[model samples]
Target: MSSTDHAAAVHQVHRDDYGSRLGMWLFLFTELILFGGLFIVYAVYRFMHQQEFHLAAQELNTTIGLINTIALLTSSMTAAMSITAMQKGNLRFSKWLIWVTIGFAFVFMVNKYFEWSAKIHHGIFPGSKDLLAKPDGEILYFGLYYVMTGLHTFHVIVGVIFFLFILRQIKQGKITSDRYVRLENSALYWHLVDLIWIFLFPLFYLIH
Candidate 1:
């Protein structure tokens, strides 16, 4: 059938349809711009206060950041593979793979929890210089660090919620080879969260 027919078919049950995808893409573009601005600000600070930034970066746990990086990258691979599996009309495999992806997401958050807990215990909070034990100049580094990583974590939370909803849709037969837009878009969101972390790890953890 024609594209119009396919969309008309989806309109009945799929609230999003093509229009939803289009809207999501547009919204993602706005998010991209917002992150782009934050990145620019980070770059400026890093360049001007290179020494302090590097020292502040060293304050972070490279091991934890690296571990999370590996986890998220691995999850992205799993999610991509699941999409491929769905395209091949393999529901069981796709479902299992999605569950695996969610598992990795859980692991990533768990690691983040431990990492943040340690930081909090050490009293390294935003706008708390005595808490962080750093000089005034070094304050900006940690400030931006918290903001960027915190925002990225929020995105991860959103992605996890989205995938859980997709899991429900799959169980109820709302998603299948016949209609995988939900899967496809959820995968896209997951990938974006992963991509953000990739940039973040190097910027915040690898400065030294």
Candidate 2:
């Protein structure tokens, strides 16, 4: 109850917040590396089979891709709004925003499933699909498509889990308007997901 004891407690709280922030940044860095490798692969393919890739790109479901893009961008907006609510110490509002974002994310995933299945059913899938009846190595284009989008899907799944954890933290009173670093970090992750899709849309569905 003494002034010195109160000061010590405040300092400990600041230190704990700093540690959480640092951990989040470190994790973000690791995520950067994981996405980096995929970018490299995309570059190599773009350079190696520019024509085939372009042709393949034209075959992609651009409408579906654009729809998914909008969904993700909307989710990102909701996430940003959630963070703002958290900063305002409005936990209830923040939770609702988070739930809204999760809903959009799920919709994105479901749309992607349809897009993929359509391609797969048409025999335009990866690994020399017999469905499309394409020539050898021609189907390689679809191979890259699957790998890139598949990896991106995995990232979304991870983001969903992370978001759920953040919500739990908020519920437990571990997070507050005064100390919600986890929300910001989760936003960063969501933005990364959006960024990847931004590039992906053009590469897989808009090239000519």
Candidate 3:
């Protein structure tokens, strides 16, 4: 290829990389705004119903919450390490780390499933007869709890799917040491998932 043509191609690759990163950042920003608004609503309601919110929080199993928190934090670490491994040209190890991260996500979902099952079994779910009989603050607390955590859980599922797709790309040699922006972006997304859970853990489980 001509030198001028080669230089233009390289510039295009760089531009694409920059554009991908910028796009991911913009998406994350929108996510932040969504959860930020929910947080503000939570804060306002908690302020208005401090006692009931505190009491409702007591119904949550802190132990299970702690376990899920640890799982996500560890998954975040694994996701980041996967990117580093790919950048370092350790494809096999990077793939292994991605699998590990997905495993952690599974653990989180399992725990959440059981937790929700327990709540539902106890008739504490939104709009249930038992929940409807509770004080308004307690009702609101569980409502927010279900909505926020459910949304975060959905994000976890999406992150798992993202990693699986990245794994496929790695296997096909599309994402390699020199071209791992997809992996990097997925890790950024996983970190956001973990960070949201960080806020949620304290808000829903530690309100004593």
Candidate 4:
């Protein structure tokens, strides 16, 4: 093949990679707007019912929140480092780091499950007799708490699935040093998950 033709082909490949990254960023933008709407609702309700919100938030377990925060932050580090490892041509090490990040995600989920179970056992879920008797502000607070956290939990599950896909691609030799955008995009999504939780942990757990 002619040198000019080869150059054009290489340029097209990079262009496609850039296009994929752009698409991912656009999707992430939509996700941000989605959560932003929820944050606005939270703020308005908190403004209207400061005392009740405060009281209800006190019921959340701060210790679990803190632990999950650390776990996610650490996982974010691992996810980022995985890309670095892949760039360094340490493919095996990259895969291991991705698995570690997935492990942390599971830990976060387990902690979340226990926390929710405790609340449910105490009859604190929405529409339960105990929660129903609470003031409207507290009820709304718990309601949003369930919704936002539940949505975030779903994102975590999706992220785990995405990481699994990345693992499969890596094993199949589809993601590598020269073509690693998929891995980078996966890490970006995971970081977004961690970032959302950073905000969530403080708003629901520490604010009280």
lDDT, model 1: 0.85
Each model's backbone clash number: 0, 2, 0, 0
Model 1 C-alpha lDDT per residue in residues 1-208, reported as the tens digit of each score: 9999988888876365687678778878887887889999988887888888877777789999999999999999999998889889998899889888889888888998888888777778785656457765478887887788888888888888988898889889988887888888888888988888889998888876
lDDT of 4 by residue, 19-77 (tens): 88899999999999999899999999999999998899889999999999999999999
Ranking by lDDT: 3, 4, 1, 2
lDDT of 2 at 101: 87
Candidate 3: tens digits of C-alpha lDDT, residues 1-208: 9999999888874437788988999999999999999999999999999999999999999999999999999999999999889888999999999999999999999999999999999999989999999999999999999999999999999999999999999989999998998998999999999999999999999999
Candidate 2 deviant stretches above 4 angstroms: 1-19, 131-137
In Å, residue 172's CA in model 2 sits off its true spot by 1.9
Those runs of model 3 whose alpha carbons end farther than 4 Å from true positions after fitting are 1-15
Candidate No. with top lDDT: 3
**Model 3 Cα displacement at 196 (Å)?**
0.4
Candidate 4: residue 80 Cα off by (Å): 0.3
Alpha-carbon TM-score of each model against the true structure:
0.87, 0.86, 0.94, 0.94
| Pairs of colliding residues, candidate 4 | none
Look at candidate 4 and tell me the lDDT of residue 44.
98
